[model samples]
Target: MLNIALFGPPGAGKGTQSKMLIEKYNLAYISTGDILRGEIAEGTELGLQAKDIIKRGGLVPDEIIVQIMEERIQTDTEVNGFLFDGFPRTTVQAYILEGLLLKMNTKLDCMLSLEVPTDQLRNRLLDRAKKENRSDDTEEVISVRLKEYDTKTAPVANFYKEKEIYHGIDGLGGIDQIFERLTSVVDQTLQKSWINLVLLGPPGSGKGTQGRKLAEQFNLEYISTGHLMRQEIKKDTEMGQSAKTYMEKGDIVPDEIAIRLIERQIRKHPDANGFIFKGFPRTIVQAYILDGLLRKLGSVVTSSINLDVSTLESIKRLTYRGKTEGKRLYDDTDIIIHRLEQFEKRSIKVSNYYSKQDKFEIVNGLGSEEDVFKRLTDVVNKSFKKIR
Candidate 1:
């Protein structure tokens, strides 16, 4: 997900620009002042605390602010990204935000600084005062506010600049023109964050279960070849018709057909942070096809993780599932064993393929769902760090 910290002087049109960015990019707008005032208005415990502090002419401590920010972030789970405005006003707060995002298994993608001349800012604020009759927009008040912004907020830009994710945009000209400039920088930054992953394992290894969780945790598109083929067949499309012919004959679909299905899924999510390919590339040929497709897309497989479940465990899980679910025809003992053998043969070859590229990982899948997920996430986190 895209996480942006927007920086600007008082009259650099941050409010207008952030709203446009939110609408265009599906980002959740987060302004610290709005969050704090919302807390006070709600009369919750944190609100009461913040109210009392404000009443006593005291600044809320960083810990309290962090708590509020964390709570706000947790409550919003469906956003594409977060647009942080009027936050991290100090260098210390910038570090705090960094730690907070890292704790959430993500990081700030960039800081977009809107640059406006001081005279232009004064004229804009004065024009706004005339239009809205805002008493706070007086000459002296605007000077103090701008000076305070320079003192407190300017250094935070340096913090991001050091990391090389800072993009300075000219906050002049028409609103649409300015937005175009912002989008140009934002689009490039988001592209860098896109990553593709492959999840490999035999049946009953929980790769499908874990793949869904990974997709949610990392804001990725989850693509399972089996699921994609089923969807295609359900839709009765051309590829579906061809796939149906092979399935009716109990034959595997051609690699080209499977590759087309994978390609279709990838194209469906042009703006996704990445994809988790679950149970695709079942053969070495398919693996090469996938690599070629990704190369065409200007991305590479970040990792091919095998969820290593023991043979006994895989058999037991399949047996239990067959008895309990009574729907998996292939879960019959003989068929299950045959399938596992085939999977083992293919998995080892594909694992070796990725190993040669230094992008293979083995995660222990014999544990509680949460435990296995934690191991998977650990591997994913390490891979993401290497990419960034």
Candidate 2:
């Protein structure tokens, strides 16, 4: 996903542009005003504190600002990415946000600074006050807000510039004109096609959620060894019985047998928009075999997505899945913990193996299913784009 941050002084058109871009791109729209009001209405403790501060015209604390943003980032909804209308106002806030995104294995893709002259801004505020009947836009108050903006926000824009992802949009024009400038940047990004998408994370991090979203959105199909096996067992097929027998033995099924099952399923279906593989090639050797199979079939594992979760969390999620899905055979806590230990080591090798090939796009499974899935979608877009 291409995560875009819109940073500028109040009345510099971030709000106007954010709405337009969000609608056009199907991205999440986040503004300070919106978040603060939502939190206050929800009556979260943080919201209550922010409400009190806003009631007195006091600047909300940095910690509170981060707290709200942290929650917003947790939603992995259907977004091309996200638009941050007001955030990271200070250099310190920028660093804090960077750390938060880094944990999710996402980073600042681009930052836009809308530059408008002080005189025009003042006039805009005065006009807004009369038209909207907003009491906060008096001459003295508007001047104070502008000054606070200068002191608190300008440096963060400079920080993004240093990172070389900052783009300045002219805010002097009318809203249509400014929005056109922003859309040009986004259009260029989308015109670049993506060929391969690698989803990376641990179990229960919603790798599947994201994979399915991409498949649906981009007209792709997804493959999962586990899902395939279950369908076979559901049909009471011979191969399903054979596989189930080996699984019950607490032994890894032979690669030839597993691969043959997969090939037969693919031949039977024979049609897909694109394909995402899940829960196969658990080891390095399996990776080689799968790659060989895809090659023979006139394709390859274009991307390998690994869902990351803590060992403890993976166990909980797997056990939960087992209980809910009647797959209790693998739900034993001791078995899961044991598998997790091996997974920790083997997954690293799997990830590094791809990283060495520069095909890995690691994502954070730290948030709710919605949040991580959103991030995963963007990564899929970016990966296919990089190669295509």
Compared with the true structure, all predictions reach lDDT values of 0.83, 0.71
Model 1's TM-score against the true structure:
0.57
In terms of lDDT, the best-performing candidate is 1
What candidate 1 gets wrong by more than 4 Å, as runs, is 198-200, 203-388
Structural RMSD, model 2: 14.6
Give per-residue CA lDDT, model 2, range 312-357, as digits (tens).
6776788788778556455576766665665666777777766655
Best by TM-score: 1
In terms of lDDT, model 1 sits at 0.83
| Cα-based lDDT at residue 150, candidate 1 | 89
The TM-scores, one per candidate, come to 0.57, 0.53
lDDT of 1 by residue, 1-388 (tens): 5788888998899999999998887788888889999999998898889889989999998888998998988776666668999888888899899878755545787899999999999999999999999987789999998889888876888888888888999999999999999999987885576688999988889988899999999999999877777678889989888877765443457888888888888888888888999878888988888877876675567788999998889999888988784434356687778778778777778999888656789999987999999999999997775544
Model 2 CA deviation exceeding 4 Å by range: 52-59, 188-388
For candidate 2, give the lDDT of residue 129: 93
